[model samples]
Target: MPRFGEDYHHFHSQPEPSAAYSTSLSSWAPSEQQRSLPPPRWSSSASWFVPPTRLLALLLLLTVALQPALARALDEEGEGSGDGGKGGDFSVDMYHIPKPFQFVETPRDMQVIEERAASFFCHTSDAAEVSVQWRKNGQAILPSSTTASAEDVPGGSVLTILPKMKDNNATFECVAENALGDTISAQASLTVYEDNANAIPEGFPQFRLAEMEEEEPDKFPVFWPLAIEVEPDVLEVNCEATGDPEPKIKWFKSMRPLELKNPRYSVLAPGRLQIKISREEDDGTLYSCMAVNEKGVVFSGVFGLYHLE
Candidate 1:
């Protein structure tokens, strides 16, 4: 029924035979023990086969003419079928699908899944509306063959490929969304070959933007363009740095770590291992940042305190 649909519900439109049709015929069919006997008139014993053969043909003809009655009897017995078969509407589906509806920790960012092992699937129940977002770690992927249809309503959005190579462990994710709230998906990972491979590998897990952090309103650092803009009785300046996985900022003054101190200034963000300095004589000095991560430390743009000019 490929021309129609592969579903079990799709029975041909013609009427189906009754269940009782097979069973009831057994009762009406001829019995072998009572089969008609051979004629006594000088006949070979082999001729005993002729009468039973003729009786069989007669019974078959009778059953053919009476098929309608047999079918009707089945209907009375609740075993008859209708066009497309009434039983086809059982409407019970028990397809086995993965459940528990949770995900493992997302793979590390910037990692690629190896070829062959690099395979993934995307899913969405709202194909007519919002779609499944493919995130490596937490980034979206665009495909040239992206497709959807209500006819295939809630269609499965899948991506499967045997990557030719791999370099790092990779995590793949598919997120399904609709007018309802979005559902973040569980993560799947892949293993890849060493970096020496000619190809970087396929099916890299998606990259993720650093998680955004919250800041305390009063403690948030502010940059002033003018010294007079702040209190004339300024005793010290405190800075607070906030970032994901923490950002370490080294305060610099005059292109170097400020060398003077009055013990009045203090760093608000302890994670930066911040140091502060203050001096009445150096009130107008310039200060900036030397921030660092796994890569290395770097300075921020210079900011001036009290302007001399």
Candidate 2:
């Protein structure tokens, strides 16, 4: 045998391969093989091969194309539904009938000295729209009268009288009227007394101090000048006084006048003061009582309160 190198060279130097063999070899190459293979078989329709971006674009176009048709259909349906339809032309009327004339405030019974002028007020709920009139003893009171006169007020009318002994035991009423209806208030009476010197002497009022009892053992008296520690308890202070003329008693806290009408405080008589202790704020509160008359005035010593811990 010849040498191996000499034999390989002699075999490669043979004639070119056949056309069919060359074609098969070319198909075996990576690029050519991929191109020659058959396409893959899908389980479903060709739509599965569509890209997600293209599918999203197609959906958006469909929605935009259908919007105007959907709107037109809704409008036609609304028109057929009559007044109850959405976006349909309609109106609603709301009204309230006028309320009948009613009294808001009425005059109270009054007592006055002889030859003194007194005024009675009559108020109504709708005074600006309603007409107000005053009547005395079932007879209409004239606006131009020497002894009595009726005058228009902001919310009602006023009946003023220059009282005499003959005007005693008289009845007065307020009448309110409007287009809707009319109403009359309860009758108010006037009492007149003769002015006598012996009944009340002309002099200044006098005041006297008194102690109040404690409700609890730890509680302090209301009239103590020094601060006293006390538990939560109701407290009371009373000032007794006598004068030539009767005096009115008023209570004060920290120099401010106390409202006697408050439910927390009570003025049993002119001089007595009662307080209910409900909170810690009542501690260290300065309290004073005063008596007033036509002639003069008197005040009690200031007292302080504190809460007991």
Candidate 3:
């Protein structure tokens, strides 16, 4: 038999064994086969080893097997390390959250005369450690002559205003702030009325008196006087006058000032004086209406009442 060489077997096909020898191949000695057969050779290049498709399949299976474990590890890191997650170190409890600011008492609208003092009040609930501030028309209010100051009270703050003409019809509000956030109260209105009486001329009772009338008369006499006829009943007279600095009116009976506190006597709108007189002594009583301003005082002519009984 030809000696089997590594290159010979690699290049050519081996001869077929005879039937009689093939049936008795197991009877051959292992030492004789080991001495006779040349050492088997393996390809040094990797290209002859495994198919590309099978290698790719194996890598894909390995990746699929490890996917769940990788995802679990990432989830644990996110939960335990960073902020804002439920299991995070910096997570905040829902029950222990800081309370948001709320208004307990809001400021109310008010009116004041010029140069008068007014105060606005604002309170908040759960205001501990929170800061309160005052604002006017969305701007912060500062201490000045017009705005006196703001002070803290028991549960809130009070803003004092020395009202001036420029502050008329201004809106004010209160703001409270804390770590959580800030809240604003409803706006309060401030109305300042003008004080024209302060600028009156330097003269006592420097005013003019116009002709008085009780009822319409068809003719005007040189000396027209106001007269009225009434039974023992209620009497009302309206005395309308206009003067600088807005005049104030008063009524007198027999040169005596009328007592305003008496319920029987009333002063009505447009300077009308009403008296409940149901006595004989009130007949022919001299009644006069007087208007006074900062400048001076003026009186209406005495009106005589004739009793018709």
Candidate 4:
């Protein structure tokens, strides 16, 4: 028997391979010749088809590259063209954006006869997302059988309260709230008047100003100016009167009969004219209210309304 090294040399030296066998072996080996040949049809088609993992990686790169361009397009569409520009077709729902509440009109100072119903209104710029509540003397007012009742109205809220002598000089305010923050309105006061026990027998209408407590029950009319000058928002000009038959009230502006159509100018109640002042045209305008019954017609003293600078 041969040694291990001797046996390996013996196997290698056995015989020279045939020409056909040598050719076949060289063709099967990895060499330049194998590489030079055209690939099989199946292999060429499979090379063009990408693998799942590599395809996903390419998609991620494309998305990242396009992100900045998409953002710029959206911003350009929303930008305003000028002061009066109405932006693109895609309108942002203003309701989604949080905005602080603002007041267009606040409650006005009121004077009402004892046992009569008094209405105080609060108007807001945008009411879709705003909530309103009425307060009395810095405390929240809730609805009850004998207490003030608050109700939601178009663009704002209304508070109705039946007053007694105890309610005189009570301060009232309205608070509005929205997603961003809340706003508190300027305070207004309520003045309650009691019936006089020593009343003269009422025959004809006699006019009395809100500042005055009483008037002589006469058939003739008298007038007085407003107690103080006030700025815009809401103003209640009241003309109190007494008569055997209740008097019908009418309001005038600049010495002419006021045509009350819009909510800006309306009578909140008899003898009480409520005006929502907004335009420059309303400045320095004289306002007066009249009380009329079958006996006679009485006009209150004229007062001018001006918008503060």
Identify the leading candidate in terms of TM-score: 4
Residues 83-142, candidate 3: write the lDDT tens digits: 434342233367676555677788777655456445676777765655678888889887
lDDT of each: 0.41, 0.62, 0.61, 0.64
- Residue-pair clashes per candidate: 10, 1, 4, 0
Q: Once model 3 is optimally superposed onto the true structure by TM-score, how far is the C-alpha of residue 101 displaced, in angstroms?
A: 2.2
Query: What's the CA RMSD for each of the models?
Result: 26.6, 26.4, 24.6, 18.1
Q: For candidate 2, write residues 1-309 as lDDT tens digits.
A: 344444445555545554434466556444443345444344323434677799999999999999788777777777787744575433568898865566777876766555544567677777465567778888888878788877665557767677778888999888877646665565688876554324223453445543444443321112333322233476667666666677777666655556567787766666766677656667788787655565434456678777667
lDDT of 1 at 192: 48
lDDT of 4 by residue, 1-309 (tens): 334444445555544544423466556444443345443233323435677898999999999999788766756665656533334335446657644467788877775545545567688887676678788999888766366777776557767677878998999998887555665566788876563323223454556643433464421224664623245377667776777688877676654546688678766677767778765867888777666565434456678876666
Winner on lDDT between 1 and 3 is 3
| Candidate 2 TM-score to native | 0.36
Give the TM-score of each candidate.
0.22, 0.36, 0.32, 0.37
Comparing 2 and 4 on TM-score, the stronger one? 4
Clashing pairs for model 3 are: 205-295, 205-296, 205-297, 206-296
Cα lDDT of model 4 overall? 0.64
Candidate 1 residue 65 Cα shift, in angstroms, is: 46
Stretches of model 2 off by over 4 angstroms after superposition: 1-93, 97-100, 199-309
